[model samples]
Target: MSKQVVFTIKLEPELRDTFMAEAAADDQPAAQVMRELMRGYIEQRRQAREYDAYLRRKVEVARADKTAGRGFSNEDIEAEFSAARDELGQVV
Candidate 1:
């Protein structure tokens, strides 16, 4: 098992009391609730970092495609989609 340590923070008395009351209402220890909250916050930050990296990679790929003349123009895309829609309409 991993060793545990005490984590301390200072907050307003009213806020602390309210948090403790909510945890008690749920039949959970205040410390356990705090730990869960901390874990959730960490996961949220990790996901944000991952999404930011993914976005950066996508932007880089798009920029590289544009640089290599492999990117399409807005008009080209619109025309292609319009032609597809017309074809579908004909089929229906």
Candidate 2:
């Protein structure tokens, strides 16, 4: 099932003509071009927003660890890696 909704937009004559011209150039309908533009814009915004949030979270965690002096030694990390690799047969 599909729902039908109506939206109204105000655009200048030049932009409208430009949209139509571009649509013709692509051999696609103006509505299709508009839909593609909207979907791409929305998807890009979502990805950017999520990545921004992830970076912010990582920075906050790193800052907290820095203030608390919470860290692992290189030898400790290497030992853990070696054990996991030896057990899992995934690395040397």
Candidate 3:
């Protein structure tokens, strides 16, 4: 990976010192840790967006099915299950 750009942020002096000390203790560069954290955050956001799109598509399809009368109603579902249970001698 090529990191040709420098990103700068301002933090409290104590926070910077503590972060540097922790990075030193872990034997890892602070920049590398920050890069990994940034990548993880990006991936999390991407997955959330994909999931949101999937749910929206599902809702749209359900709505279309309802408009076309192509899906079962709640009462229809309950009646079908009740009949199946009766056939199997199971309590409702």
- TM-scores of the candidates are 0.90, 0.69, 0.81
Cα misplacement distance, residue 91 of candidate 2 (Å): 29
The residue-by-residue lDDT of candidate 1 on 1-92, one tens digit each, is 26388888999999999999999999999988888898999999999999999999999999999999999999999999999999999999
User: Candidate 2 or 3, higher TM-score?
Assistant: 3
Alpha-carbon error at 67 in model 1, in Å?
0.7
Clashing pairs in 2: none
Cα shift from native, residue 69, model 3 (Å): 0.5
Angstrom error at residue 50, model 3 = 0.7
Q: Candidate 1 — which residues are off by over 4 angstroms? A: 1-4
Arranged by lDDT with the best first, the candidates are 1, 3, 2
Q: Give the TM-score of candidate 2.
A: 0.69
lDDT of 2 by residue, 1-84 (tens): 253765568999999999899899989998777778989999999999999999999999988996898977789899999998
Tens-place lDDT digits, model 3, residues 7-88 = 9999999999999899889999999988988999999999999999999999999999999999998999999999998988
Best by lDDT: 1
Q: Each model's number of backbone clashes? A: 0, 0, 0
Among these predictions, the greatest TM-score belongs to 1
Score residue 88 of candidate 3 by CA lDDT: 87
